[model samples]
Target: MDRLKTLMDWFDVRLGVREILRSNLQGYLLPRHVNIWYSLGAVLLALFTLQFLSGILLLVYYLPAADKAFVSVERIMNAVPYGWLIRTLHMVGSNIIVAVLLLHLLSVLFMGAYKKPRELTWLSGFGLFNLSLILCLTGYLLPWSQLSFWATTVATDAAGAVPWIGEGLVTFLRGSPSVGAGTLGRFFALHVVAFPLLFLGLVGFHLFCVRRAGISVPPFGPSARPAGVGTTFQHEVHRDGIPFFPNYTVKELAVVMFVLAGLVAITVFAPALFLPPDALEPADPFTTPDHIKPEWYFLWAYQTLKIFPSKLMGLAAQGGAMTLLALLPFLDRGEERRPFHRPLFLTLYGLGILLLLGLSIWGHRS
Candidate 1:
């Protein structure tokens, strides 16, 4: 009993549950200048938590092998009480989470929140974004459906385009000449164990940085703090800003709760429409699906990949696109944050998105 009490005390101290709840509930702090953009991170966090829980529930029934994988999923949909709902929610939540994270990133970039003291925060977030994308890509293959199978085949084949090591790398990834049972198993392990663990660690670091630094104040505002200059708790919380106790924390909690309730309600009541089951058939090395395409998020890349010439120049185009995505931070080193200030970059971004959407349409048709 004594040891139990000691452990409990340590937990309370580490979480600051008592202090945080007391302060937040009592109205000790409030957000003075936050907007909807500030809510995306919290919303995405809630979505991720839902995805994790639903995914755990799914693992209870999912089979990793080629023969059983599709049947197992069908059983979950038809036999398991709420399995279909959970699976649908998990899929929708994954996509929604990515969308919100992108919104948060764009908002932060435009707001100039990436300026000085918060660069690490932004960097950690960038890492989180990349990790989330990987999580999505890996998870997509777990269902082992026809769509997932061909999608992986097409994607891995693209990776093989990497210069000297392309063919060898592709061979290693597929574990054979094509997408087979081995590929499914490898992707399943990565989706379930590897990516989630990395994401969990990165999430901890991301939240810690957010709490320690607090949200970035908007530039050119009355409440704006100078770059590299963070105020003391006394000044920021008690004197100048809200205490973060009752005020801001309460709002954050309210937002989280509302999002969770909404997501769960939707999942339970109205699941997203899934593709036909025929699409889940084991991938055949000989025949390709008529509409061979990627998930919506990667439509742009797939389209870009399609446009590349079969010759050396095609390899260069594909390689350069991948490198650009990987090294965006380094490529655009300008300090200016406002969209108006970076007109050229903004124009390029718009044009790129447009081209991606167009290509996705064209690829889907072809």
Candidate 2:
């Protein structure tokens, strides 16, 4: 033990590993009132790590060709050792990460944690969310199954409705007038290469901003500190808050373990339950599925488009909603951070959540 400690001390002296950890994790002061809501960031990181590793493994066997993609997936499932588990985890992790990220966004918004100094943090997070969705869309097409192929067809066709530039966008996305091998290759490149790099860069910046700005204080709790008061808040936390290493890390670890265990249980017991046998079939461009739909994360938007009279109008509305969300930090120019304090904002946000849930359910049924 002494010899091992001596070796570690030697490396730490040379690499400053202990110093980096001290500055970033152990010495960091999180708001005492922060609860499980804050832990969603860690959970997201965990899911992303799983995705990164599983995706690399999947790429080893995946063939990005219209003729071979579906067959390759089958081979991965049946022939490759432990490939089924990795594929299942990747699929399940994609859905769960989106769900958790949405919840985290809502939590941050309701708490008004995006105000003032943390604007960039919110922006970076929003960027990450959108990139994750893009990653999902790109990966969805990788299996080249009926569900994936048809879903990509519908999605790109929708993109082609973007007024004057729509044609070019569709051509660029599909690499042809139709979904074929070119489209598969493009999406595969995006899913495995482009999106991951952007996501990682944004994640690094987001964490840097978080570390620099520190976690937002609870707006309603007794430990709440006023916004715009910088060093004073730090002083209070320094005096009153618990050490993040043992106190908060322990809670975060528990949450991570619980979520991981739940994910593993679901993946093991009913892997790919969400995907039907029809969806697993090879892509057939000639015959469209009777009732084709996107993944559940996009169902709300899909339902909204169905409800609207004009396709262009529906597309614009969806795009406009995302734009509004991205620009929320600048639009919501109030110092108030608590939901209870901002009644009008809270009401609107609540209604938006309700509408989203209602649309998702309607889309699922329709």
Candidate 3:
């Protein structure tokens, strides 16, 4: 213990490690009224860290070349130690993280935590939400399996539905008119390098903004919605609020632990749920599967495209909806934060969520 303290003292002298911890860890504060839903933010952080680590371990045996990628993954599953476990965690964690991220965003929306002074936070977070989907899209192609190859084909084709630059967008993503070695190389680079870097930067900025603005007081409290102070008021840690360190941090960890347990359980008990039959087959460019569908996350959009009269219209509708979500704070500027206080918008939001869920299920079973 003494030796450890002496070593810490040596580094603390140069790095001020103790002060950094003191200020950022213990000194931070959060409203006591915040609930488990708020813990979803911490859950997301944990999920992302797990995905990042698992991806790195999988990368150790992963080959980026088109001809070798599927063989590499197959070898990882059969030859490398604990390779299947790491791959499952990375793949399953990708889906879980997106789900939790969406829930977190919805919680904030419902709580009206995206209001004034928190607008930037909301925008940055929304950007992360979209970026996470893109990360999934890029990483999906890295497997170079039949499922991934055709899914990328369908996705890039959707991108090609855009107005004038559609063809160019498709060429840029695929590096040609078709999915091949060029597509795999581009996606591998984006997944491993370009996209991850952008994600980390946005994550840093989101946390900073959240910390700067303070966690919003739950929509109901003595000081939560004081009369008409909504437009004028900004979220501030109450003087009587709890310290973020051991108090709220413990809650975050509890939630994260629960989530991690479920993730591990699913990975162990039902690995085949995600690794569908065709996913095991190598890319066969000369042949297309009878039914090609994206992973569940993109299913709602995919279903929407199929239901729409045209790909351009479906793409436009999706883009316009996302734009509204991005501009929500400005669009709904009002003197209320409590969700039920804004019944009409709340009802619409709930319906929107239900519709998306319905579409996803339809896409899956179609």
Question: What lDDT does each candidate get?
Answer: 0.72, 0.87, 0.89
TM-score of each: 0.80, 0.95, 0.94
Model 1, span 74-169: residue lDDT tens: 788789998878888888788767767777877776676665555567777888888888888878777777778887887888767677888898
Top lDDT: which candidate number? 3
- Model 2 worst lDDT window (10 residues): 230-239
**Candidate ordering by lDDT (highest first):** 3, 2, 1
Candidate 2 runs further than 4 Å off: 223-225, 229-237
Cα lDDT tens digits for candidate 2, 53-153: 99999989988888889999999989999989999999988988998999999999988988877889999999999999999999999888889999999
Residue 224 deviation, candidate 1, in Å?
6.4
On TM-score, the stronger of 2 and 3 is 2
Question: Number of clashes in every candidate structure?
Answer: 7, 0, 0
**For model 3, the run of ten residues with the poorest summed lDDT:** 226-235
Question: Clashing residue pairs, candidate 1?
Answer: 24-245, 24-246, 29-243, 29-247, 145-280, 146-279, 146-280
Question: In candidate 1, residue 366 scores what lDDT?
Answer: 60
